[model samples]
Target chain A: MHSPHFSVIFSLDALTGALFLLTAIGVVATRQVLASLQLFIAQSLLLSLSALLLGIALGSPHLFAVAGITIATKTVLIPWLLRHTVSVEVYRTREIDRVLNIPSSLLIAAFLVVIAYAIANPLLGAVDLPFARINLPLGLAAMFLGVFTVVARREAVPQLLGLLALENGVFFAGVAIVPELPVIAELAAAVDVPVVALVVGLLTRQIHKRIGSTSVGRLAALRER
Target chain B: MELAAILLIPALASGFALLPTNRHFAAPMTVAATVVVFILASAVAVRTTHTGRVDALGQWLTCDGLGALILALVALVAMTAALFSWGYIRIRAGHSERRKEQHYYALYNLFVMSLLAVPILANVALMWVAIELTTLLSAFLVGFEDTPEALEAAWKYVVLTTLGAVLALLGFLILYWGSQVAGYAPFTWAGLVEAAPRMPPALLWPAFLLILVGFGTKVGLVPMHTWLPDAHSQAPASICALLSGVETTTVLYVILRLFPVVGGTPSLDARPWFVGFGLLSVAIATLLLIYVRDFKRMFAFSTVEHMGIILVAAGLGGAEAHLGAAYQMAGHAIAKSFCFFAAGAVATVFGTQEIAAIRGLVRFAPLTAVALTAGAFAITGAPPFAVFISEFLIFKAGIASGQYLTIALLATFVVIAFCAVMFHINRMTFSTPLGSVPATALPLSCSATLAVAAIPLVVIGIYVPPALQDLLHAAATAMGG
Candidate 1:
């Protein structure tokens, strides 16, 4: 499988991209809330890995900063915040009721990947970027899948996981697309991610305590008559 | 300095509120901070009216005419809402739950801080973060009631809006990439406009769509407005005032900032999309307002309708149109916040927000009834009200721009929404009482907020203050009119 043309870093990034897509699919397919959270941690890890690979390949310190921050926030801080905030009951609950069944959700998720590539294809053709070819479409696919996960999952933690996954999708694309951004923006973005989790996590705990469940998708009390 | 101080004051107030302080400390401190911010924002508005721009720190902190106008509106609402909270929240929390009140105030200040940050922060990426923070910060405020319903609303609010924000982040990143592709420029609104023409149309087109759909969700554009009603209805009146009033406006401000950037690229046109989505929102919201049973939810739907109208006005194109858009923005903030306050008062008096529950409020709660009636008249675009004038200006501007069809449709929806709102409010206010109720006196701060908010609601429609007129004119020009 070794080719003279493929830089090892590029090949590794492709592998990372593949694993990233897999983790997104895993998030959609998981039944246990804990599994979805675990998948999200893996996905965030994959995201930081890609950032590190891209940072090394592109020789950009900012991507490295992106890598460090994504790990600190998405992987470590978010889970800790959720563990502290969301009740153990939500994680222990199995067989989450989703809007769509897993098999159909996967089929639809597959369709979303095609759509993501179709959407990314034009932009790639429009301007030349070296790494965009690998990262852009895959990042977009993960993002679409993340959105799909959010739609399908009713559990608050998984839903929150879907949201963070969606963000991971954007940064996954961003790390390649704008590698040398002013680290100031990067730092601000870093702060933003944990707050999303903390806020959502705390809200989830409130819902669970008040309503005795975190199946947020099932909430229908506030609609018009 | 004012731009920086406007942000600094709120941040510090939120800090002070968050500290281990007495329960009563947060409300007045927040109110004091907002008063200072209002004065500063007005100073910036006046400065920009004369000078056209105020830059606190290059692109990172800048306020031009449009920014100042939004800043001023947010501050005005924040101050009134803080005042409203002092009385309303105390009543809602009861005397024993002092700590809950303190948390509410702390969250309230941070929420206000996020709204203020949007316009004044010129850097596009940082601006996106600020918009996201608005959702995160306010999520708990929406759930402050800690009811199952409030929790539902807060969850939906955070998850959906944050989803939209994540999507928009990619859009901003693409914009940053486009800027780099064009040659390095700071990722600021001004820099994006400067970089737009040189950017590949492919990049700009997708970025434009992503941001439009993404932030459009937060802006409560229909199909994406589901969470808005829930959050706005479920939140306390003070928070509702900010949520329905300036919070939505502040997010829409971000989407509107894209207009000039998208305008610079010759091959790209965001107008049709703007008008399309705007019309759709207005149409749907008008329909919802018709069947809306809950008064608070009714006001919330009206917010969606008003957002649509402003989006349509912005897309209608021309100086008059943009000016109308600016005017409508100001009018909606003032009137909508008033409507929410009145609704809150009615809800408190009657212990329900349902339209069917209250009848002949005038016979019983005359003061609350009168405030609700006035707010209703103001929001539904009654003659000599700011909404009517701004919407009128928009209609005339549409004719000038030759977008007769869009204007006609918008006019029709606006009228239907007006009738629907007035119809329900009319029944709530003047109709004969179905049941007898004891007379009630509203909290002092709530009454004071309504009276103070009413002044601008009445005066702006009748008289256009010269500096405000100049500021609106400058804002319209900044909007690419």
Candidate 2:
């Protein structure tokens, strides 16, 4: 019975890992800001599901609460806030202007994924923990991809989403390693997320009002004299 | 009595100053509070001189050799800054509202309270949180003016440092994980040091690296130091003094704490990385300082230079080097705070920060001109100042450790930075005033603060107290002498 339960977790972990990779690729390849936001949300949702399944398999009720918070906040509240604050009109009009083209980003993302897998394979093989070795690298790759999105995107919303994605990656990585991190620390982190979201939201409103666009390039006006 | 007063006075005064009443009361109240804290801290240092240590609240707050030195520096400078802000803020009283003045004092107290907490906290995790709280509280202070530029600098500062802190958090987590492997129960400085010998090198190495890079950013090491100049230049001068002087040093103290744990573990030499980053920061900041246009920013860049100096000192990795680093931390706190106070006064008089714009300061404000010149000379490693002694000690340590090239490079950059800074200081002080802005007389508090800050810069150059010597020796010993 324990073995079957482990097998179920293993499959869900694999699916979660694959979804993370896909979302990362989508983040890199997609040039439209709205599409990238959507992909990021999808990635966050998958992370919640993975955390929830792992919690059930491990019989850790706290992780279930973590999962619920992750979903409601990351997948729902944050994206909705981003969408509303960064109005749909702006999202539809502005495409993600990248320094590197889509093909190049995809190629770079592929290279990164390969490097991640190569690094994780031997390391994870030595580790005794279940699913950590695989899940860790996937989470890292998603983080790297999130960073790429942030670097690639010119628009503020996409960059903001990229930051959120990066946090999600870190969260997933933390879950994979120590699924039962002290509840106090976990709650602190959870509380921090929405507060940051709200702050960023306020900043976004200010940015829009001031510049009429939320591009990183224009924000460089305050550089050192 | 000492610890309680150091913590509570600021906390209570800050609470009182936060009341939305009179604009007149804020500055004086803050100054009084800081003075009391400074006096208490000095007494603590004096008491520790005889007893060898001061432990408080069941060892949750401590004044060992290094912490005593830090506490003394923090108290003295914070007190002086508080004094200076009295005159500084008074100049802006008519321009600002009653409420804004109150808010400034409130944030000012909070910032100082958090900085004081960093050196005294016993738990390493608690220390990290306190450092983070310092960032949060000071973020408002940095953006106190709320101008577009100030806002932007504050945002950059908060974002970059917060990111660095998150990495530091991960590093702490990794350390906790490693400690668990080593059969440790609680994660505290004492606990970690006790279990240090058994921890695996793999975990220790990665954790140390993460922490070095993480806290290194807060300390304004190169590449990660982009926010320092902007934020420092934008903040009120008193706060700038705290930010650059004591605040960065407190973060560096945490890195210093980790050295014993990581340095003791064989097969991991963290020195090379520290030296590399130190040299990089020094060289970059030296070159940049030459071209810096803003006088305030020129001072800010010097902070990066000094931090690099301290890092290189620490990287030298010996008892003497550790002592040099400790001395450097103390001296820089005094010298840098004086520099900022003077710079703030000059900025107030000239109504601008541009180096090219402000000239003939001596004719305009002779006292400020003298203070700026003296501060510039002291900070640029001139003789008869504490920074010179500390830098000399560092170079000597570097040479003794066979890091001849590092010492030579450090010297070259120091020279370059000196020339860059003196060039501007000379121009600003000696040259004819560009405009007809009269030399407005400053209030008594401002001159007193500058005098207090300046006296140490001059005195420590010529003499090292026995207690300070003992404290530095002990701190060095704590670093694994």
Candidate 3:
């Protein structure tokens, strides 16, 4: 009875990790702003699913709380905020402007995955958990990819989304390795993330209004004279 | 119960700020509430000194000597800022700015409430939450003016600091994992410190490094310090005082909290990293000072410089050095806030933050000119000033610890910074008046606020009160003295 449940949990965890990597790729590869936002929602949903599975497998109430938080904030609230930020015209037509083109960004992301695996290889042997071995590498890769997205993106909204993506990766790693992390911390992040989204959205809108563009490259006026 | 009041009053005051009645009474109420918080914070500090540590609310809120010291600093700075705001806001707020008054005070109170939470939190994760709260709360305050420059500064502050903060969360999570593996429950600082000696070096080193780089960003350590000048320069004068004087120290308190835990790990020293980052920040900031054009931006860089000094003192790793670090934290808090208050007065009267735009403050406002000059003198570590005493201790500690090279380099950078800061402020205060300076009188509240800030700088310089000395010693020991 336990073996079958364990097998199901293991497969679900693997699938979640794979989906995390896929959505991460989709976030960077998409050219349209709305499309990138949709990919982020997919990524967050996968992260929530992973959290839910971990909660069921471990029978921990706290993991279940975290799962609820990830879904409530990331999957539901943040995407809505991002969608509301862009008007219909900009939403439909805005190019997800990037410092690097899609093919190159994808290539670098794959390189980061290889680097993550390399870094995780030595750390893996020290841990006895079977699931962490798979989850940790995927989490690290996603983190690297998220940071890359932040650095490469020129527009404000994508940078915000990239930061959220990084948080998702961190959450994945935390759930995999330390499922018993106090519920308060997860709840704080859950509370804080939406507020951040609200502020960033507000700022992005203001930036658009004042400067007539959301491109960060145009904000070079405040530097030292 | 006092702790509950300490936290609740500011939050309540913030709520009050939005009410119509608060419009006429906001400044007075803010000052009154902050003074009450100051009294409560001193009581907690005294309790911690006598007992060594206090845990309340079922171990959720913890206060050690370190917490007490930082708490007192936050309270002290908050009070001064409130008093300063009394005049600063009155002068700055006009017809167009009337609607922003409520928003400003509300955010100010919430910001203070967040800083107050940091020292009291026992759980590392919760502490990170409090620190992140400070960043989020103040982002709006930083960009309060809503000008293009202010908005840009606010965006950089939120983005850079938030990124650094998230990295800190990752670091804490790793430590949580390590603590669990070592058979301790997660989240408690004491538990992690107790389990530190048994933890693997690989896990401990990465955790420590990640935390250093992470919190170091908020501390305005170089390379991650791009946001500090912008945020500080853009925020209101009183808010600038809080950010420069108290906020960085509060964040540094987080790094020092981890010292005893990470210092216990056998294979990791963690000192070299601190020293390297500390000296690098100091050297870089000093170089930038010579080229600084804005007085507020110059003071902002000075904050980065002082943070480096505190970090290096702590990083030197000796009883003397830890003690020096504690004193430095106190002295810099008092002195830096004084600089910001004075600089704010100068900017307001002269109607520009640019160093070149204003001259002969003495001719325009004799009293403020004198206050600004004294502040500059104290902040530059001039003799008989509070900062000089703390800096002397730090130098002595470095010599005792045989960090000869780092010490010599540190001294050179310190001297260069002194020269640059003095040169800039002297031109602004003592040189010929540049234009038809506005004849706005410095309000009595502003003068009183400057005196209140100045008294500590002089008093602490000449004599360390017995209670303050005891608080410093206990705080030093808490950091592995």
What lDDT does the true structure give each of the candidates?
0.89, 0.78, 0.85
Stronger candidate by DockQ (1 vs 3): 1
Model 1, B109-151: lDDT tens digits are 8888889999988777888889999999998899988889988
**Any runs in candidate 1 off by more than 4 Å, and if so which?**
A1-6, B19-22, B438-440
Candidate 1 vs 3: which has more TM-score: 1
Sort the candidates on DockQ, descending order.
Answer: 1, 3, 2
- Supply DockQ values for each candidate: 0.90, 0.24, 0.61
Query: What TM-score does candidate 1 reach?
Result: 0.98
Kindly give the stretch of ten consecutive residues in candidate 3 chain B with the minimal lDDT sum.
Answer: B90-99
lDDT of 2 by residue, A5-84 (tens): 78878897888889888987887677677787789888888888888877877777777877888888887888777766
State the displacement of the C-alpha of residue B336, model 1, in Å, after optimal TM-score superposition.
0.5
- Candidate 2 residue pairs in clash (backbone atoms < 3 Å): none
- Point out the higher-scoring one by lDDT: 1 or 2: 1
Clashes of 3: 0
Stretches > 4 Å off in candidate 2: A1-4, A21-103, A115-127, A154-161, A187-213, A222-225, B1-14, B40-64, B90-96, B438-444
lDDT of 3 by residue, B361-469 (tens): 7888888888888888888899899888888988998998788999999899999999999999889888988778766677677789998888898999999998899
Q: Candidate 3, which segments miss by more than 4 Å at Cα?
A: A1-3, A83-93
